[model samples]
Target: MQSMEGSNRTLVVTEFIFLGFSGVHRGQSFLFLLFLAIYLFTLVGNGVIFTLIQLDSRLHSPMYFFLSHLAFIDICYSSVTIPKILVNFLRQRHTISYNQCIAQMFFLMIFSATQCALLAAMAYDRYAAICQPLRYAHLMSRSVCVSLATASWTCGLLASTIHTVLSTNLAFCGANRIHHIFCDAPPLLQIACSDTYVNEMALHVASVFVSLGTFLLVVVSYIFILSAILRIRSNTGRHKAFSTCAAHLVVVIIYFGMANVNYNRPSAGYSLEVDTLISTLYCIIIPMLNPLIYSLRNKEVKEALRKVLGGLKKDSGLPQ
Candidate 1:
């Protein structure tokens, strides 16, 4: 089963074993059910948020616009790997094909990079709304929002293309055991039989640029936003202004906190268990909570949902 060209390595192994939560000594069944619940929440939460944003004209602004996009990416991101993991947990064996592995890694990188870009764009949106309230609409006009979203998707695709190309270039002739739930760049790179120096360099450079660049942009944007907020003399005015960004602030902290903890570590030194837990945060848990925190906590979305649900109920009664 030579999936790729010149892949005589298939003579050695047919499929690679995914050493998932199986490495955990005890509580395997408990962990499986835990992850299952998280996956379900992710689907419903993100799904509802996306639907609400699309249906509600009130959420057509850049902030909610980018948020809807984030929820979509998160839904795709979690689906790319979690369902397979859940299946493996059920069957007691975790293995993925060579082709499937590459596909998973590619999609993961694409969504991961896209999420970073979206978050950075959201920061800039808040900055404009708060610091340049006079020009909020002008700054985040329909054309401008479309441009930003396009750029985010383009950057994500380009980054994933680079990594996928580099990853597939390497040979895996030895033990085909991947010690992670999904086919991540790091673990797959480690398993390559050929020289991975180039791949590692690409990975490090991309990771550093995305992580640091996005972090810096978010911080700087918020700094200016805070400065603008503090300038308001009226306490009520200040409180009202801050309330608009409170949910965004929470999301930024949670997302970046876990990202920094997971990716900023030294590549050579890290525990597998620690990596697994961190992976759970950014991949499964964060995505599940994002839609809830952003939508359920906000008045606009709730009002819109109420109207839509009422309309739906009326239509259902009238029709049948």
Candidate 2:
């Protein structure tokens, strides 16, 4: 699709073509099946986690509260890109409307930014629980938890709004082919015919403020948490305290690591295949790993899962 600019008579793009899969001429079916399975797993995994947190009284706490938001974000984040990719695989022409691409980028930024804030919130929750047990209740009271969650979403909404509004104003009068797997800010900016100085600056500022800022918060929270853990004289106490934070730390490392690579890397000397792989890992695989990481590492979550499953079985009149 194309649109005419009034004075210059320039052809404006009404749709975008995805070139992420352009090099692949075969095994499209296999790729589709793999992504389909991953998407389904991401939904079920995050869904079960979200449901279990809501249903199980044992799982109700500030930590779990933040976790539920994370799970939901993961669901929304993967949904923004994966389904479109799936559909594109089935069609000969891999394309998305310009408006859809903008919307996709908007939601994608929202969820990713939200998850970063949520993870930092979770880290602070852990710090409160471990470093100040006596004050943990007051620190993470229901109201406080709600406020933190709300703030995280607000952060995402504000950041996404800035990027999306800026993105829509750019002129896509030349190539509309997005080089990356999805309609991300970087890929979209690369295709804009107009000067992207402001957009590029915004992206850089956001990378620092949103990504680096939240990451530093997590780091600072963990520093205090680790200090308190080390001061514990009892081996079991130290071990137990550390264990509470292990899964979150792992997730933070994986998330920030991939994000730094995906967004912060030098724009030069990167191949499309490399970019696609990193994006797939960052956007696609990370969400699926979150619930699994929590489930496998967390005894409470696993026990809750077992109980929930057992209850379902008992309700169905199956063997205990």
The best candidate in terms of TM-score: 2
**Candidate 1 structure lDDT:** 0.83
Cα lDDT, all candidates: 0.83, 0.92
Q: 141-185, model 2: which lDDT tens digit per residue? A: 999999999999999999999999999989877688888878989
| Candidate 1 lDDT, 1-320, residue by residue in tens | 33444635244345678765767656767878898898889998888888988988888889989988999998999999888888777666678888888899899989988888888999999999989889989999999999999988888899899999998887786568876778878887767778999988887787777767887899999999899989999999999888888888898899888877765667673667777778888788899889778876789988888888889989889541
Clashes of 2: 0
Candidate 1 deviant stretches above 4 angstroms:
1-14, 24-28, 317-320
The residue ranges of model 2 lying beyond 4 angstroms of the native Cα positions read: 3-6
RMSD of each: 3.0, 1.1
lDDT of 2: 0.92
TM-score of each: 0.91, 0.98
Q: What lDDT score goes with residue 95 in model 1?
A: 86
